[model samples]
Target: MVYPEQQLSERQRYYNAKEIAQYYRSRPWVVIWRALTIVWLFARFVLGLKLDEWFNRAELNKFKRAGQLRQILTDLGPTFIKVGQALSTRPDLVRKDFLEELIKLQDQLPPFDNALAFSIIEEELGRTVATMYRQISPDPIAAASLGQVYHAFLTTGEEVAVKVQRPNLLVSIKLDLYLMRWAAGWLSPWLPLNLGHDLTLIVDEFGTKLFEEIDYINEGRNAEKFAKNFRDDPTVKVPLIYWQYTSTRVITLEWIHGLKLTDTERIRAAGLETDAVIKTGVISGLRQLLEHGFFHADPHPGNLFALADGRMAYIDFGMMDQLAQPTKEAIASAVVHLINRDYVELAAIFVELGFLTPDTDIMPIVPAIESVLGEAIGESVGEFNFRTITDKFSELMYDYPFRVPAKFALIIRSLVTQEGLALTLNPNFKIVEVSYPYVARRLLTGESPEMRRRLIDVLFKNGKLRWDRLENMIAIARSDQQFDLLPTAQLGLQYLLSEEGKFLRRQLLLALTEDDRLHTQELQRLWDLVKDDLEPKRLFDVALSSLRVVSTEGIAAILPTANTINSL
Candidate 1:
């Protein structure tokens, strides 16, 4: 449902901390650190603390600390619950125990007063509940941090879920958000995260996303986009939004009666094959990430259901991801190179995709990849082990200078998350085997053409042929570039072209030792005398010497031009 006309009231949507204090009843510090406090409890889970019978009473209290959080969010209502939903999917952000508890929040909240619910329905839809549904469930079928769902049938005869926003939810959210924002301001001088990257940015991001979730209009449009992306694929289901019955605070959708993908008992009882279910879900997730580029980011167990017909249903598009065209191609290409066992290419793609700096040295990360990957590149993904991949790579990227791309963070979460669900279903699903063929085909048959070309251009222009890159390097050098590329890459390449150029100096020294023939290993080996950072240019001299050679390794010596990559 598109509600271009339904705008939130000024007072409901906007308020300062002073204005908000009355409703939420906490100082800014209490409300904001509540987030940090929840994060600390989440840390216990990530650190693998035994919160069950093995944990000490005080240590076991971590469970209560986390549980108390779930209770508080329920008390806070819609905005916080929505916040919880977003937090649940962020593996790159929250720790595992927190993910477990946050996910446990699927349908656990005190229902809003039925009388008040009806009154709000009347006020929102401008119609009575009886007119909308023949019979509305007094008890909500499910409740969460956000809103509760009531099973109903339209008077015209359709089973639907009526999601109602908590009464006075806007007032509470605005006040809590104001307090959180102010607390961040007050705490900035004292906290490491507050100054550069910390709780403040997190709260602000959480607050913004929380408000976005409250906007039924945003979810409506996100759902519409998903339905359109999969219009041709019926195996995956997203409930059709009934716009006429929708408003800023209320959303109505076709009711789906199926076991959530994580519910093993209900699924097994319904006589479905768990392995096939796992395959379809993972494959479809791949399609969403690679083919369509727009996907439901929060496809946690609660949001995915296994239908009677053996199809997986994806719902709850409150948090979704959209990759830019260039980003999509870069990721797709990276996948292909990874499958083909081209570590250098994979490293290069990282730079192309803006995942790392253009001048960043990837040689350091290569051994880590080899250490993690070894010779197991083509094995069936069903048999691939996720623990080995994650454990070895946990600090891999962190070893190099990098920041997680917002999109990649969510996408990685999606894959690792489905792996968790896969453990429940098949317990042996290796995602890589599935991912390999998809990537292999892309590399063999030109999967992401633009990205491939961009990568090739980058590798050739700057990587193998240092002398040829003089033009590109010259532009950066001549322009007074600001990035780290200037002092290192541009300067290094600048020296390679001049009489003082490292490559020329090295080559002249080597060729002076022996009459150098162009484009041979002996020539490159001799040139290596200069230095490895300057080693890439030696290969370029080979390419320029007009040797009729076409080795793939030889061609790979080049690096891509990046001044124009940002446009993508």
Candidate 2:
């Protein structure tokens, strides 16, 4: 099998020899890091850290042992799991067997020091810990690489979990990431080494994203957004954040002590319907991404807790995902096509998303989709292996040259993760089978207005109609539209779809419903604006500004005073 030299082999457009050597010196400590990660796996599993003398005599599945090791790696905390996750996607650069082991890693972790937690709370609240919390826990109930969370009672008697950045976390992470970034850039272009990618680009994205995550203030805003998005449903629990107590490095949210999905035996013992709980978990998460477009990117068993009320609580907003409206629309369309098994349409959707180059034949990727979706098609959502489908997609990058947008990749990860949680509680739980209604509604017709009303029925930062896409709405209303089975962007369909896109987002919000019909005058005005500026953002800016007066506070959020706000 002669493999032709691929595009990845092209000389690093940016990598330099000095930087290459710098990367290895700064970051290759990870070779030792990887070795230690593996050794830790062996100690926890093959060696049986807690196993007794009789344990060696008793036989158990080694595969299960491997899975346990992976869990421990994730529990070991964010850095290792972060590395594992990155490696999980770049199979071309790493060992397949190792990738398999890493894939099992859970993003959940144990809680850390109460003393440190107290310090964080005190610091963020700009007062003594006692002043911030009337009663603080003796120790942290949860801990991750970057933060430790403590359950405490506020002076007002509110039970809360205060998350504090691990001291100097940003400084530590940046040093290591800088090294890795340098190494990937320097080495990724070398033949027999590129491993089919510019490692630097991946590393660079991680740096930017990771740094954003360290800012608890940003994470708090994300949590607030998700909470609002899911407000219609009481079954979901996104603990409210105490914004006043939050800062760049500290966040305080409502305390939730509940069973993680992984506590299977406990869940069973509690007389809870494990299968139902798992399905709810799956649905809630799907609705978060598919419907809300903002989601907690990391949802391992640890981050998701089952409250006494049976609502699933999602924690750790540090790692979150933002889906641009276009990406969300594309995913909705792809999902619809996938349900119908219109492989050709699915293939073309991938191309539209820049996953596949124009010349790359969709024929090859078609079988790949079918091969993965084979057991999934027409099956109830709960009957198919969602994780397997996602893994297959990641595997396809090797066969075809394409760009898997990182945001979409995270969306895929979130889906696979929720599926894993469901499987843990009920092996028979099939995500694909259960997701059929969502697919059927989207592909066959669309979301019932009621469902749409439940969430995103309000105007946002700028009060405007969600999409007063007058021009296209008028076209459709006027019978000038042509229907095509193939996916075509409805310039009108595009705007009215997102809250930020709509002209009367605020009106839709005030009414809490979307009828989406634009009057003739409005359509004519929209058409004139559309003709003036083809850019959606510019058009939105004009409409939004026209709708309301820009306040000084709005400008403040956009251009926060440099000295007052720490430079990220």
Residue 511 deviation, candidate 1, in Å? Answer: 30
Task: Give lDDT for model 1.
Answer: 0.61
Query: Poorest 10 consecutive residues of model 2 by lDDT?
Result: 1-10
Misplaced by over 4 Å in model 1 are: 1-4, 9-103, 171-207, 372-391, 442-448, 451-568
- Candidate 2 lDDT over residue span 312-335, tens digit each: 888777677776555555676666
Residues 1-568, model 1: lDDT tens digits: 2264566875555333345556456455666566666556556544444544355654556666566666655555566666675566444456665666777767766787778777877788989887888988987888655677889888988888888877666656775676566666677566432122244555555565566667777788888888888888767888988887888778888899889876788888999988778867877787787678887666777788999998878767766777777776777666545544557777787787766678888988777666555544436333445444554454554455544443565676667777767765665566665554554333222334464354344324223433322233232222321222213433333333433233334333333234333445644543443243344665465434423333333233221212222322
Q: What is the C-alpha local distance difference test score of each model? A: 0.61, 0.59
Instruction: Compute the lDDT of residue 305 as modeled in candidate 2.
Output: 85
